[model samples]
Target: MAKADNIFNIRGRLGDFIFCQRNGKTYVKRYSGGFTKAATQNHPNIKVGQERFAQVSRYVKSLKQQLQPYLWRQKDGTFHNQLMALFLQIAKNETEKTFNELIHELDSYSSLSNKSLNKNSKIDPSTLLYDAKTNKLNLGIIPYELAVKYKDMYLEVATGWYGVDGEDILLSKPNIQYIKLDKQTKNEDVIVDITPAEESQTQLPFVALAVVYTDDKGSESPHLVHTVMACFVKMRNI
Candidate 1:
C-alpha cells in the first residue's frame, strides 16, 4: 500500500478562513458562509487528484515563510497566533486605503489646476510633492504660501534664454496671470506686466520676473527649448 501524503485540514468555510503564514495563524470567519464555493472552484491547482488538499499544502508553505518570526509562538499557542493575524490584516488594509486616497486627491487637484492653465503646460504633481514630503509639506500637497515660496523649485523656463532673471516677478495671489511669450530669439522670454493688476497701496517697485535657467535637464549650459506660459505662483497669504 502506498503511504498517504500529510494533509492539513482547515474547518469551516474557506473564505472565512484568513490565513496568515507570517504568524502561522488561521482564523475562522464568524459571519458569511465562512468560505465561498467560487473560491474553492477557482483556487489554483498545484497537484492533480487533490481537491482542497493541494490548497492546504501550498498555503502552509507560504505561511511558513511569512510566519517565520511567529512560527514558534504560533505553534505554542493558537489563540495568540489568531489575534496577531487579525491585527496584521487590519493594519495592511488601512495602509493600502490611505495611500490610494492620497494618490486620488493628488490626481484630482493636478487635473483641475492644469485645466485652468494653458494647454501646453506640464505640471508634475509627484515631483512637486517630493520636496514637500521631506519638510512640513508632508504628502506633496502644496499650501499657497509654501507653493509660492517654492515656485522656483517646480517651474523651469524653456532652454536658451539666459540672463533673463525671474526673481522680481511676484506671483499674484488668488488669480491666474497670463504669461506673454516673446518668440524673438533662440531662447524665449516671459514678461509679467503687474502694472495693470497692482494694488494702489503697494509700495514695492515693479520688477521683471523671467525664467533664466536651472539644472532640471542635467545640462550645465542652459537649453532654452521648453517654455511654459501658464505657470502660477503659490502664495502663502492672501
Candidate 2:
C-alpha cells in the first residue's frame, strides 16, 4: 500500500480499541454486532473499544472537538493548555439554545471577542495598588517576564487612554495623565496633567501588565508584552 493508503489503515491502538488514521482523522473500529467505524476524539465515544485509558492528548483533543467552533474565539490558541479545564466545563454544560444565543450576541452586540478583549485588556490602576501604610504602589500583577527580560519594571507617570471595564484602551490619544510601566525602575513611562473631566473619568487606573508568549524559537520569551487591566479599588488623587 502507498503511504497514503497506510493513513487509512487500522494499525494503531487507542486505549482498548483500534484506531485508523483516515484522511488525517482518527476513527475507532468496532466489531461488536458487526464491522463499523465511529468518530474518535469525542467523549464517551472515545472509549468505545476499551476501558483502560486513552492518551492524554487524545482526551484533551476530544474535549476540544466537543466545543462549538465559535467558542474557539475565546482565545487565540495562546492559552490552550492552561484553559483546558475551563473549556471542558463550558462544553459540558453548553446547550444548543445557549450556545446559539451566545453566538448571536457576539455577532450583533459585542464589538470585540474574548480573544481581542484579551489583546488590549484595560489595566486596573489597582494592579499598582498604593499601600497608604507602606507608601508603595503594591504591584499586584506587574510584568514579571519584563522584569526578567529588562531586569526590572518601574512606574512612571504617562498618558494613555484606558477603559472602565479594563478590556480596551486607546493608545492613540495623547497623554491623558496616567502611570506608566517602564523598562527599568528608573525610566518613566510618563504621566501628563489631567483635566477635571479626565480626572472624573478615572474610574479604574490601568498599568502596563506583562505577559509571556511563545517566541520564534518555540520557546517562551524572557520578555513580555505589556497589557492592561482594571484595579480593584477606585481611582483617587494623590
Candidate 3:
C-alpha cells in the first residue's frame, strides 16, 4: 500500500501505541520484527536508572572478608563501588531489598538527584518519523505556534547501533536542528514546523520528544489530527 502523506490517516487513541504510514514507509514497528532491539533499548529513562539500585542487592551476597581485597576500607569512610559488596551485607534482607532504601545507600556514597529527574515530564515523548536513509525525523506537520513556542525544546533522538535499551545507547547530537514547520517545507524555523539536523537522522526504531525547561522538565505531544498534525520521528524498513 502507498504510504499516506498525512499523519491523520493513521489514527489511534491517546494510550494506543500504533504504527502510521508516511510517504512510502512506516514507523519502526515492533510487530514487523525490524528495529525491535532499538525500540526496546530506547526504554523509558526510569527503567535505565533502576540498574543503580540493582547493584546494591548483588553486593549483599559476598562476604566482607571476600571483598576486602577490592572492597577495602578507605580512609574517607564513605562507601565505594568496590566496598559496596562488603558493606551491603549488613542489610537484614539480602534478597528482599527494595530500591527505595538502596537509593539512600547510593546517595550517601555518591551524588543523587534531589528531585526526580523528570517528575513533570511525560513518561513517553511525542512520537515522530525517523528517516533511516537520512538519519533525520520527519516531524510531518505541527502547529506553527507550537514550533515557535517550543523551538528551544529538544528531540533526544537516539542514533547508532541499538544497545541494552537506552542505558547503553549512544545519544544522537544533543539538539536536533529545526526549520519552519510549514506546508512549503523550506527548511527554516519560522512559525510553522521544526526540522532536525539533516545529517543526524538514523534508522533507529523509536524516539522521545520533549519540551525541556531550564529545570530539565520535558513534555511530549507526538501526534495530531488533520491540519496541525504532528507525527513522531520513528524508523522502520517496512
Candidate 4:
C-alpha cells in the first residue's frame, strides 16, 4: 500500500484499486479481488502463505485494539503494514523458535513507537513490582531531572497487562496517567491495578511513556510529540 494525497480524500473501491484511511490519512492499494478453489489448490504455497498472513493479521489487529488509546494520532498511514511485516519476519523461522518464544521476544524492543527517548524514560526492572495480594503493579516513577529538562511538555504514561489464553489475547484496560512536566510537579510512583475478567491472572506487563508539547494557550502540537516503550517485564502470575 502507498500513501494517497488526493485532494478529494477518496476511500473505498474504484475499479481495481482500494482506498482506505488510517491515522487520519488516506492510502491506496491494489485489489485483485479473490481466486477460485482450483486456482488456490494448484498453488499450495500461495494458499499456505495466505493462511499464515491471515493469522498474523488477526493477531496484529487484536494487539492494536488493545493499545488503541496509546496509538492515538502518533502513527503514520504505513504503520499497520509495517507492523504486519515485522510480525511476518518473526514468524519466518518457526523451527528455530517457537511461536510463543517469538511473541515473548517482543518485550526486548519497542514494537510500535520510536525509541528516541527510550534511554531516559526506561523503567528499572526492580521497580516493576507486582503484588498478588493487592492485585496491583508498580510501574516506577519518573525522574525529577527528566521532568525538569522538558518542563514545557506533558508526560503521558501508559501500562498494560497482557496474556494469551489459547486463541484469545487477554488485555486489561490500560492504566494511563498524564502529568504536567513542570520542575515542581510531584513525581509520584506509577501504579496500576489489574483486575481482568478471566480466571487466569497470569500476564506480562509493558509500559510506555510519551512527551506531548503544546503552546502557551494549551493547544497541542502534533509534530512535536515523542513516544517510546519504557519497559516490559517477564510473565508472572499477578
Candidate 2 lDDT over residue span 61-110, tens digit each: 54234322212223334434533443333333443333223222313212
The C-alpha RMSD in Å for every predicted model, in order, reads: 22.5, 15.7, 26.1, 15.1
Error of 4 at 44 (Å): 4.2
lDDT of each: 0.27, 0.32, 0.33, 0.57
lDDT of 3 by residue, 1-238 (tens): 2233444554432243455555555543333234567666677654444554455544433322322321121123322443454334433233345433432332222221111112233222232344545545454433233445455444332222211121122223333333332233334322212233332222223222333332232333332111111112334342
How would the candidate models be sorted by TM-score, starting from the highest? 4, 3, 2, 1
lDDT of 4 by residue, 104-174 (tens): 54442333223221232232344455555666665444534346556667655666666676666666665
Worst 10 residues of 2 by lDDT: 108-117
Of 2 and 4, which scores higher on lDDT? Answer: 4
Clashes of each: 21, 17, 27, 0
TM-score of 2: 0.24
The superposed Cα distance between candidate 1 and the true structure at residue 128, in angstroms, equals 21
* Candidate 4 colliding pairs, count: 0
- With a 3 Å backbone cut-off (N, CA, C), the pairs that clash in candidate 4 are none
Minimum summed lDDT over a 10-residue window in model 1 is located at 159-168
Best by lDDT: 4
Using Cα atoms with residue i matched to residue i, what is each candidate's TM-score against the true structure? 0.17, 0.24, 0.26, 0.51
Model 4: CA > 4 A from native: 1-45, 95-149, 179-202, 213-225, 228-238
